[model samples]
Target: MAFGIAGTVAGSADAAEPRLMAALGNTVLTMTDIGPKHTQVSVNDKPVFEDKESDMLSFVGAYSLKDRWIALFQADTGAKDCPTRFRILEVGGPQPLVSYPFGSCSDAAQVTIDNDVLTISMPQPGGGGEAAWTYRNGKIGRTK
Candidate 1:
């Protein structure tokens, strides 16, 4: 269905407040920046997961017909060797079912999961080039 966290959940401005939240069908993913390096992700108004990260410069997410979620973000920190990190989190579970790391993260902005194949286009830490992965046999494996 509709993706992206541009829309603020209405009737919630007076509530605790949400920095950004995206909806896919009946499931909702809410993110609140706890600090410069910490973020909390919640579903159905209940906080479920918390992650430590560098300053997030960009974030995007998408959902599949099975209600599985894929969240991608670029984490830029104050380091030369490890300046950024591309973090991916799979949602709709008690915890992340699948996780992947790319480069210091992706300098580009494209992440998609069609069916069970996940194609990610991002540079590696030392120039490894774009990579691909697929979710089959209940595991995530690099394809390219």
Candidate 2:
């Protein structure tokens, strides 16, 4: 996937609508207005993923796979114990490839990607260690 112009997604063309979060090729990711102060992830003008009862969407990160783009997002409810959802989505796909009920919203800061491995440092109640997943050749799986 190529970003091509790159700036158009974050440029003035999308200034009139919801803020475009990221883009690669024709697949555009945006945080769209859902209701009063609520937003969700929209891909190619379609609402693809939204946290249940979540009021805010936080972009964790995005990675460029060999053939596609994978992104991580958090839907936060602003509660201390509420499990912040860690959503992984393939750009332009129908839905999230995986959604893990991770730790608190603050844990979203621990998510990262290296090469093709996506890792999350889990706090207590999340198995108390690091969980990893791998994306390669258009496939996703738990990294062994």
What TM-score does candidate 1 reach? 0.65
Whole-model alpha-carbon lDDT for candidate 2: 0.59
Using TM-score as the measure, which candidate wins? 1
Off by over 4 Å in 2: 1-16, 92-100, 103-108, 112-115, 125-144
Model 1, runs deviating above 4 Å = 1-16, 65-67, 92-100, 112-114, 125-128, 135-138
* Candidate 2 minimal-lDDT segment of 10 residues: 1-10
Q: Taking the tens digit of each residue's C-alpha lDDT, what string does model 2 give over 42-120?
A: 7766676655467666777787755567777677666667646566777645444545544334453465667755565
In order, the Cα lDDT scores of the candidates are 0.59, 0.59
Instruction: Provide the RMSD of all predictions against the true structure, rounded to 1 decimal.
Output: 7.0, 7.7
User: How do all models score by TM-score?
Assistant: 0.65, 0.61
Question: In candidate 1, what are the lDDT values of residues 1-144, reduced to their tens digit?
Answer: 122255658654333346888874567768777666777767666675556756663566564626566666566765676776555656665555435445434466456666766666555555676655555433556666
In candidate 1, clashing pairs total: 4
Per-residue lDDT value at 101 in model 2: 48
